[model samples]
Target: MAAELMRETWSGEVSVVTIGAAKSEGGTRSAMVKIGGQKTLPFLFAEGAIPHKPVIALEIWDIAPLDWPEESTKPYGQSIKDPLAWAQMCVKEFKAQLLCVRLQGAHPDFGNKSAQQEAEFIKALLKKVDVPLIIKGCGDDEKDNQVLAVCAEAAKGERCLIGSAVQDNYKTLVAAVLADGHNIIAESPIDINIAKQLNILISDMGLPLERIVIDPTIGALGYGLEYAYSIMERARLAALSGDKTVASPFICFIGQEAWRAKEAKVGSADQGIMWEVVTACALIQAGGDILVMRHPKAVEKVNKYIEELFIPR
Candidate 1:
C-alpha cells in the first residue's frame, strides 16, 4: 500500500473583517474592499474559502517624504509636490484599491499646518477621490489623537478606516472613531502578545474585532525582518488554531519597510538590483494580508507573485 499524504486539520473558528464601507452601503466611495474573510490560513484556498481578497493601498504623504531614496521615488517625479494630484494619479493610473493619505507633515515643525489645515486637506481628499479612504497620523500619541479626531469627524459617515491607535493614546483615538462611526487600524509595535493585548484593550472599548485591523510592524528585508515575519506567521497560526482574540486580520507596511531598508533604497545594479522585488515577494508569502507599498513597479510585480501563490490550481 502507498503511504498517504498527511495534512493537519483545524477545528477552530476564524474571524472575517470587512474594512471599507461601500457607498451603496453608505460611504462616498463607489465600493469598499476588505482583506480577511478567510476561513483558513493565508493562501490556503483549497482548505477553505477566502471571502475577501487582499487589498493594496497606494500610500500618499501629506508632505513629500524627506527620507525616501530618490531612486525609489523617481517614478512619481514632481507629483509629490501636490497631494491631490498625486492621489488622482494613483487612482486613475495605477488602479489603487484604496488610498491612504498620511498626515505626516501636519506636525507644526513639519507642515506648520493647523488642525484646521489637516481637516481641510482630509475633506478635500474625500472630495477628490471615491476610493475608500484610510487616514493615518504622524505617529504622535497626543497630537495624533487630536488630529485624527478632527479628521474622523471631517470624513464623518464615510465610514473610512481612521487610525494609528497606539497603546498610549488608544482611548482618545478609539473614542473619536466610535463617535465618528468609522473603522480603524490598531497599530502595535511588532509583538504578538502586545498585539493581542492592544486588541483586547480596544475591544474592551466596545469596538468589535471586525471593526479594527492589526498592524504587527514590518522589518525590512535583511533588516531584522525575520522576527517580524515570524511574529506575523505565528499570530496567523494561533488565530487559525483558535486564538479568538487574535483572529482579526493583519496588515503590514511593506513599502515603508522596503524603502526603509538599505538594500531597497540603493540605486545601483551592484546594490539594489532586484532587492525590492525579492523583499516584497517574501513578505507576501509570509502571511502578510494587506501590504502598504510605495512603488508601482513593486506593487505590480509582487501582486503577480501573490496571485500565483494564493489562487488555487
Candidate 2:
C-alpha cells in the first residue's frame, strides 16, 4: 500500500473581516480586502484551508517623516512632503494594496497639531486612494484618543481600521470606532493572556469580534524577535484549538519595528534592506495576516515571497 499523508485537524479558524466600503456600501472606496478566515497556520495548505492570503499595507505619514533612514524614504522622492501625493505614490507607483496613515503629527510632543488637522489630512488621503485605509495614532495614549476620535468621524462609513487600543486606554478609541462603523485594532504587549484579555474587553464593549485585529506588539529581528514570534505562534495555536478570544487576525508593524533596530537603519545598503526583508518574512511564517511596512523594496520582496507561498502548485 502507498504511504498516506497525515494532517492535524483544527477545530477553530480565524475570523474574516472586510475593510473599505464602496459607494453603494456608503463609502467611496473602489476596492476592499478581506483578511483572516484561515483554518490552519499561515500557508499550511496541506493541513487546512487558507481562505484568504495575507495582505501588505504600506505606511504613510500625515507629516513628512523626518527620522526615517534614507534607504526607506528613497522611493517616495519628492512626494514625501505631501501626504496625498505620498499615498498616491504608494498605490500607483509601488502597487500597494492598502495604505495606513500614521498620525504622528498629532502627538503633543511631536507637532502638537489638533485633532481636526489630522482628521482633515485623513479625509484628503481617503479621497486620493481607493484602496482601504488603516488610521493609526501616535504612541501617546491621551493624544491617540483625541486624534483618532476625530479621525473616526472624518472617515465615517468608510469602514477604515482605526486603533492600537491598549489595555488601559481602549475605551475612547473603541467607542469612536463603534460610532463610526469602523473596525478597531486591539494591541497588547507580547503576552498571549493580555492579548486575549484586550480582545475580550473590546468585545465586551459591544464591538463584534470580527471587526477587531490583534496586534500582539512586534520585536525586530535581533531585538526580541523570537519572543514576538513565539507569542504569535501560541496565539494561533490557541485559535486553532477553538479559542475565540484569540481567534482574531494578526497584524504586525514589520517596517516600524524592523527599521527601529540599528542593523536595519545604520548599515550598508545590502544590510539595511536585507534586515527588513528577513524580519517581514519571519513574521509571515509566524502567522501575521496583515503586515504594515515602510520601505518599498522590502514590501516588494515580501510580496514576492507571499506570492510564492500562496500560489497553488
Candidate 3:
C-alpha cells in the first residue's frame, strides 16, 4: 500500500496583499507581480491557496562588482563592466521579471555619488529593461536616507520599488516615500520581532499596508539558515493566522546568503553543487515568496520546487 500522506490539516487565515505596479497601472512593467496570500502553511495545495506563483528577481549593481568571486563573474564576462548591459542581459537572457540594481558605488567610501548621480544610473538601467526595478542602498543610514529620498522624487510616477528602510532611518525614508509616491521593501536583520517592528514603523508613517514588502534578511544553509527558516515559518504562521503587521509580502536576499556561505555555491567540486540547490529549495519550502538569487542553478532549482509543489485545484 502507498504510504500515508504526511500533510496534516491546518487552520489559519491571511489577507491577500499584492506588491508591484504595472505600466498600465502607472508603473513601467508589462505585468504587475503579486505575492503573499496564504490560507495555510506553505504549499498545502489542498488547503492553502497560492494566488501568484513566487517571483524570481535577478540582482545587479551600479558599478563593476570588485568583490564578487571569479567563478560567478566568469559567467557574466564583459557584460558586468557596464551596468545597463548587465541589466539588459539579466532581463533578456535570464527572463527576470524584476531587476534590482544596488547602488554599491554610492557608499561614502566607494565613489560617494550624489542623489543625482544615482538617479542618472537608475534611469539608464530603467531604459534598458522594461521590468519593475528595485533600488537598494549601500546600508549607510544617513547616506541611504539622503539618496533614497532624492531617488523617490526622481523616479516619481514610474512607481519604482525603493527600499531597505530600517528602524533608525524609517522616519525620513518613510516620509519621503509617502510624499514621492512609491512602494517599499522594509528591511530588518534576520529577527522576527525586528521584522514586525519595521513593518509597524512604516505603517505608522501613514504608508498603506499593501504597498509594503518585508525583507527579514537571509543566511544560507549551514550559516544560520535554520534560524532563518524558523523565523520565516513563524512569520508565515502569524500572517496567515491574521497578524496584520506580518502579512506583507516577504523577500529574501538569496544570492547574498547562498554565495557568502561556504557550504554550496562557493566551495570546490568536492563541496557538491547539489548542496546549493538543496539550500535554495529549503528556503522556498520554508515560505519565501520571492527569492532574489544570482546563480542560474539556484533559480532553476527553486523554480522546479515551485512547479512540483503548486498543484491546481
Candidate 4:
C-alpha cells in the first residue's frame, strides 16, 4: 500500500497589501506589486495558496551613500550622486521590481534636510520611477516624525509603502499613512511580542490590519541571522495558526543588514554579492514578502533564484 501523505492546513491568511497605483487607480505607477495573502508556509504550494511571490526592492538614498564599499557603489557608477538617476538605473538596468527610497539625508547627523526638502525629493522620485515605492526614514525618531509625515502627504494616492512605525514612536507615521492612503511598516526589535504589539498599536490608529507590514529587524548572516530567522519562523507559524495581529507580511531590509557585516567588506566583490544573495534567499524562505536589497549583481542572482523556487515541481 502507498504511504499516506500528510498536509498541514492553517486557519489564517497573511494580509494582502498592494503597493503603487496605476492610472486606473488614480496614480502614475506602470505596475503595482501585491504581497501576502498566503494560506500556508512559504513555498509550500501543495499545502495552500501562496498568492504573490516575494518582491525584491533595490535601495537608493536621497544623498550619495558615503560609507558604502566599492563593491556596492560600482553598480550605479555616477548615478549614485543623483537619487532620480539611481532609481532609474535600478529599474532600467537592474530591472528592479520595486524601489526603496531611504531619506537618509533628512537625518540630523546626515544633512538635516527639512521636511519640505524630503517631501520635494519624494515628489521628484515619483516622477522619475513608475514602479511601486517603499519610502523609509532615517533612524532619528524626531526627524523621521517630521520628514515621513510630509513625505507621506506628498505621495498621497500613490499607494506607497512607508515605514516604519516602532513601538515607541508610531502614532505620527501611522496617522500620516492612514490619512494619505499608504501602507505602514511596523518595526520591532527582533522580539515577536513587541512586533505584535506594534502592529496592534498601528492598527488602533484606524489603519486597517491589511495595510501594515512587519519589520522584525533582522540581522545579516554571521551577525545573529539564526536568531532573526527563528523569530520570523515563529511569527509565520503563529500567523498560520490564526494569529491576526502578527499575520502581516514581513519586509526584510536585506541589503542594509547584509552589507554591514564585516565579511562582506573584507572579501572580493563576489564574496560581498554572495553574502547579500544568501541573506536574501534565507529571509524569503522564512516568509519575507519584500526584500530591500543593495547591489545589482546580488539582486540579479537572487531574482534567478526566486524564479527557480517558483518553478512547478
Top candidate on TM-score is 4
lDDT of 2 by residue, 1-313 (tens): 9999888999999999898999999999998889999999888799999988889999998889988888888889999988899999999999988998899898877798899888888888888889999999998998898989999999999999888899999999999999999999999989989999999999999999999999989898988889999999999999999999999998999888888888876658767678888988999999898999998888888899999997797
lDDT of 1 by residue, 1-313 (tens): 9997565566553566555566676667777776776667667666767677666778899888888777666778888888898898888888888888889987666765667789999989888888888888887666787788898889888888877887777998888888888887888788888889988999899888777888888777787678888887787788778787777777777777777777665557323425566666666666666777778777777677777775568
**How much is the lDDT of residue 64 in candidate 4?**
98
Lowest lDDT 10-residue stretch of candidate 2? 264-273
Q: What total of clashing residue pairs does each candidate reach?
A: 0, 0, 0, 0
Question: Is candidate 1 or 3 superior in lDDT?
Answer: 1
Ranking by lDDT: 4, 2, 1, 3
Give candidate 1 misplaced runs (Cα > 4 Å): 267-273
Better of 2 and 3 by lDDT: 2
Write model 3 residue lDDT over 76-157, tens digit each, in one string: 6799989898888887777887877788888988889998898787767666778877788878888888888887777766
What's every prediction's RMSD, in angstroms?
A: 1.9, 1.1, 2.7, 0.8
Q: What's model 2's overall lDDT?
A: 0.91
In model 3, pairs of residues that clash are none
| Model 4 lDDT, residue 271, Cα | 84
Decreasing TM-score order of the candidates: 4, 2, 1, 3
What lDDT would each prediction earn against the true structure? 0.77, 0.91, 0.75, 0.93
